[model samples]
Target: MQPINKMKIQFDSKSANEAFARVVVSAFASQLDPTLEELAELKTAVSEAVTNSIIHGYEQMEGIIYMECRLFPESIEVIVRDEGVGIEDIEKARTPTYTSKPELERSGMGFSVMESFMDTLEIQSKVGKGTAIIMTKKFSQQKDRSFSSER
Candidate 1:
């Protein structure tokens, strides 16, 4: 909540927009001197959230995706929001390998990956309304432990 720097950007909910989200998030966080691993995790998490918004939330149709990055002195928070068909079952959605569209090759790992990458991941969705994801990671002087694997 208390970030040293804050940034906000909005882009179309398209697959192409995913790259922008990742790049911008990484660039903004670069000011903190986060490790490459940390930056990658941030990018991956952002990609998942933005992809979900574009693929599921907006159903690939043209829509807007709002992303906010808050860089704290010892932590970071990224919020992604979409004004599209909201999630019906947030509990189930959070479950690993749970995808509303299984046929879409989606691993349903969006929420799972976000949870794994960040210290906190929260999702709020309402049917026919929209979905918002709030992800936060607190940095520690200790070695990076946000994930089990180095990659």
Candidate 2:
């Protein structure tokens, strides 16, 4: 389905940019009229996605991160991508408390947080290429209009 509103951004993959990505995404999601809790969750999810790109994808090396937010009638889709050393095992990476860099003492709950906050999450990656974390969230305050006409 085509999005009613969409926004995309590309920024340096610095740890500092994590907050920038979150605020950008959350601002885009505001058009959906989500509750405060929904907004907070979306921010947290965006933070995790961007951090994963910087921390795991680039391993803190210099890189670029791309983010896209698409708004539908009742939900929003967010995509965070990076071109860096990709994951060897997507399944293992999604597991709770799994950190590729255990020495960093990371909580390793990025994926878990994203999964819990968003309605759905999809990951795409290729070794030596990059990773994309695509997530969608449905706002409880907005009713689904896609199927209403059918009834």
- Which number leads on TM-score? 2
Say which candidate scores most in lDDT: 2
The regions of model 1 sitting more than 4 angstroms off are: 142-151
- How large an RMSD does model 1 have? 5.4
lDDT tens readout by residue for model 1, 30-115: 76667888889989999999999999999999999999999887788999999999998899989999898988888988888999
Off by over 4 Å in 2: 142-151
Residue-level error in angstroms, candidate 2, position 139: 0.2
Q: Which ten residues in a row have the lowest lDDT in candidate 1?
A: 141-150
All candidates: CA RMSD in angstroms? 5.4, 4.7
The residue-by-residue lDDT of candidate 2 on 18-118, one tens digit each, is 88888888788887778889999999999999989988899999999999889998899999999999999999999999988899989889899999999
Report the alpha-carbon TM-score of model 2 versus the true structure.
0.92
Query: In model 1, what is the error at residue 68, expressed in angstroms?
Result: 0.6
Q: Assess candidate 2 and give its lDDT.
A: 0.90
